[model samples]
Target: MDRTLTTATTAKIADAATAGSAHAVGLAEWLTRRAARAPHKPALTCNGITWNYGELIERIERMSAVLAAGGVTPGARVGYLGLNDPMFVVVLFATARIGAICVPLNFRLSGQELAFIIGDAGVHTLVVGEEHIAVIDAVRTDLACHCFIHRGGAVPGWESADALMAGARAERSLPVAVPVRADDVAVIMYTSGTTGHPKGAMLTHGNFWANNLNEMFLWDMVSTDVTLNFAPMFHVGGLLCGSMATLLAGGHLMLQRAFDAEAVLHAVAAHRITVSFAVPAMLLFISQHAAFEAADLSSLRLIAVGGAPMPEPLLRLYGARNIPVHQGYGMTETASMITFLHPDRSSDKLGSSGTPPLMTEIKLIDASGEPVTAPGATGEICVRGANVMPGYWNRPEATQASFTPDGWFRSGDIGYRDAEGFLYVCDRIKDMVISGGENIYPAEVESVLYDHPDIAEVAVIGAPDARWGERVVAVVAPCPGKSITLEGLHAFAEGKLARYKLPKELRIVDALPRNSTGKVLKATLRVHNVATATGSP
Candidate 1:
């Protein structure tokens, strides 16, 4: 595919985007407008099935009718539990069409854990993939959800998504897209919190639009771009970065259910994928795969990395292959992107998280709650932008505590800025762990393990891992005369916590180091364990 655009064409595309931004009220309207503009263009492909823009919109409208027929109304929460598939996108758009909120649950979570989020969100309708039906079934009795729709296959006591869509199509009439304002919530993404429970971040349609515009201006994504999406759609980085941006730009999407390093390489070569988003771990795995040296990656124009810093060695490896790695920084609250480092400066500003996006603002404040004006002064990173979420769902206290009185979102991250205004993140105030792009709150993991009979007292910390960016290390004071094994702890916490959040390394201490106020001195723990926090069973 030719990836060239003349000056006039570039200007024309920018103008079009600016004009569309003025009129597009929500995500549902974007698909309708795009289909009208390019009905025959391929929009999404997954599981050997391809859907053009025209067909895709029709499917969305049919799904919307199905949802409406099931009593789904504006402001209702609709949950989706699945991997990366076209139907996941369908549910997102379909929910947006009816002005309902889409709650994309992490498929990796345990059934009980999933129930808490579903109950907290008050989800009225849930759509589950076949692979996850058993998990949901185990917790069905505990949930107050009204409707359960299963995709991929039929299951007892569940509505068939395929059957519902077919019926809606046969009915010949589709529900009109609901009129929604820019500030209306499009998705309620749950982020694990320091309080040992997940908080749903209410991301508005305007937030998504702002992030999309930021990416379009920086990444220069075009309709000719073919993006391969293997990142889990449950995460904001996966849903809002390359996947939604590519669709908003009218590009083609090659959707994969999960990330497979070998498959990613093959797909990039065979399909000539031009743009993709991945975490550092995915990139590391891809570069280490046996096919890395032989795979053809000439078609790749940009590979965006987030969730963790891109190690310099991996950056050099990809740089040698002539593939530019665009490192970015953001969180679920920011709709996935805040600061973006263009590939041009990726090497020069090696450890920096780049500058704020076109419409985003980044500032650092010292411990005294004052702005740190001098370059290289360490402070807590704060953000202010249209792309930032308005607040957390139904958590007024959390919403208030997360923002300063002046309206800036407190990122709970410590970083410094260079003289050139580049952001360099150093530590997290909440001690959240980013293991392979998934956010794991140490408090949450510790809470689960505290219930273990063999564990008298426990504190979880993230230890540096070469491959996974960081590995969960459980520092424990075992019960008197009781020995705890890593396997035993894993088995104990198996159904209570997500597999990724499980302790990879266990450390036994006579007693955890604590300050006068009785808080665990995690810094001391990190200093001692980081060097030895290697090897996972």
Candidate 2:
């Protein structure tokens, strides 16, 4: 009896030890708990398919096992080049499960650019979507990775994702139990290179969880909220704010492969999407679509806009339609949103980026590194928060330089806070155009031009000028059936802009060059050797 009692006690102690060690707070572990708690809850809905929390967890487990079997161990870099498919989410969580870092390649990048990132990140495996297979094929010779997984269909020398998942089912296998710590680097998001080669921002699992918490707090997200992800999954705004936020709140996510204004409009109504995030340009396009007048938008309660300056007219339109436009501010370094304008203050605090979310501290500093305390004093915005990335991947010097001695990350954006503690962004310090002796912020000029009825899309960039250091130029895409002339722009901006802020040159095109997140690629515009004068300024 004594021996049996001792054995029972030992078994109980072992079980207690196991229970204590079982809980993990990594980005992916939250999903596992959600699955256990709400197995029947709709988790992801995309392309006519809906997966419940339980089924989604199973798929993620299978994908994680598949990745492990393919020699992807802890700390391995896995590159993904794909559209905004639900599979991307699976791959991301799978990477997190095995403690591997996911490097989501921007499909819009050139073959050389893609090769550079792949090599820099030391990626051993690449997963390419069907549409981008040719893009990978072009750069395969330069890529160091030997393993390729294709998502849509069979490709020579590429393992089919469908087949691999099927094999996992046939084998009745489970994911290898790899310990993933909260601080483990989950993703290395490459910055969109407006100046030079992109640097990878190492976002740890803790950073992701913090961002999700911020999203939940700011958006007041609930599990019943049906969210739509129209933005590209490769971008932080789409992945973090759109899908991940919903997943964190135990809400349903509707995924789109790509952004089509009509498709987004239809999906919102069809799926009863309650919340979404988009760039200013996307919001404009969707609002202007013909279906906007007919589509049942009663379900959409909140829409967050970012990535560019939000035009006042767009805000007014949403207000008129009884939908709230919440403008947010953040970058790749912060995972997603650091500051967001509340829906109630969208009109009253027009153009303000809003206050910093909980646990995020924001301060502005001048050139001499002195803090700007006075309200309305423009300074480089700096932030420190749990959501902020640990540092640039493999770039220690850059990482060190990004933060101040006090541990705040320099945002490089020139902005100021109002008396009410609302944040208003002026412009990017690097993007400031200096013509002769005057400092001209392109956003100010762009905002003025955007107000014009004839203009559909506008980007202000500084063109090289031997005479004036740099000349203010406007690259515009006119509204349908409307033509924009330099004279018309000058007349429209005569009173609103100063002489130096006015566009010295105008180039009308079919569309403006934009990044995946709808940010106008001003660097690309500067290289266009086209110049036309409607008349001498």
Candidate 3:
């Protein structure tokens, strides 16, 4: 059966049974319930403005009316280009309330890239933030989207988002009633697409709801907790972990426009935030800053880190301060986290990404596609759960290729599980180097390199070789005012790594290029090496 047709049929049956009150369990309904349960509790805070649950719900309903008036129909795609502001959240829930799919475009993308996403998603209406007005204007002619709703700093011809909300509020109009089903797609998030063109991961309402349950159960979050969100909302990490999780718990969310080491520290101190989700690089910067030692982090109960591995030294630094750095492992396809190393076990299970939640199942498979049951046996990590995305939007072949015969979603990450079921990520399947018939996971070698005192950052990639098929190459970024030699690195890794696993070549660089989420762009590095050696522009 056609997916949209099935959804429409289900919605009709549900709406008829409950008189249009039977819309599926989605983020919009989640917010409505929270408002009814605790109307006076703080829902969101940003730019020094606070909104209680009742106020936030009212605004979302009005925004829904605005979208409805603008001709956004159920199942239509609505795009949002903005920073990490409250308006982003408002638009997110508002779209869901009216049964529209929300596509939040990456602000860091070039005009061409942004235009591609906007065009591909078939977004008829756009909500733009002040910071990205010029970017959208440049690509406006190239895009197929219509009806721009400016969030702030409005251009002369664009409609004011705030004015629309005020008008809706004054009119006291309710949102157009529509039946949104659980299986309906709520978001179409474009992946980073490290290898090729980006693909949009279609996350259904059920997928996101299951992910929220996983977070609340694994992290032990409660309604009283105050979470701080600094990551960009365009990413799944920020959307699910920072915003959705907090709201699902009926907790207050303190939003930051963007990440600044000092600003994050100040927000935590001022807001008495109980939890924060950051990338490993963000944690490293925060720990090394001067304000870190003086910042009052007494109220912080958890610091969950993801995007990349947390260096051992940084993990130890937080452990010494009586703080735990919980490691998380997931990707856009899994709706953020598939496993989370609990804070209490962070030290004991160092480098482990913990166990899957009650609703999820994880396993590994060898190259031949057989299951790896032996303890500590490495294989491609596969996940089975409701949290897994439905499929990549409009990419049927890619979507079919991403799953196993039995329906497990292939994670593309090579990893293993210990005797106790704790997951340890080895490396990406593409990143593992086969040198002279020996398999060398770069993450293992990189973990050892991180201990070198003179090395600030490191990325291990496989360079082409005539003798070994592939050679292990270490791209080193030196510590401030410090440098490292090839001999020094070998000496440091002598006992820590096997002979075949050691890096055979060292290339010094000032810094490694990272994406907005702080994961080193290894693909970019690989391309640069090839371009330089071949003298290609």
Measured by lDDT, the strongest candidate is 1
Q: Per-residue lDDT tens digits of candidate 2, residues 1-537?
A: 011112332333234334544335576677766655566688898898888876676677778888888999889999999888878988998888788889998776667668888998999889889898987798788888968998955778889987887677512465554667667899999873333456899998888888888888888899999999988888888888767878877899999888899999889888899999887667777888988988888898899877665777777887788888788888889887768888788777888999998858799999988999899999999999888888998888889988998899998889999998899987676676655423466766777789999899988887666445467888888899998888889898875554556888888778888889998787778777544444342
Writing each residue's lDDT as its tens digit, candidate 3 over 185-266 gives: 9999987443335679999988888888888887788899999998888988888875687888899999999888899889
Q: Model 3 compared with the native: what TM-score?
A: 0.78
Error of 2 at 50 (Å): 1.0
- Of 1 and 2, the candidate ahead on lDDT is 1
| RMSD (Å) of each candidate, 1 decimal | 5.2, 11.5, 11.9
Order candidates by TM-score, high to low: 1, 2, 3
Per-prediction TM-score to the true structure, in the order listed: 0.95, 0.79, 0.78
Best by TM-score: 1
Encode model 1's per-residue lDDT on 259-335: one tens digit a residue.
Answer: 99999998999899999999999999998899999999999999999999999999999999999899999999999
lDDT of each: 0.88, 0.79, 0.80
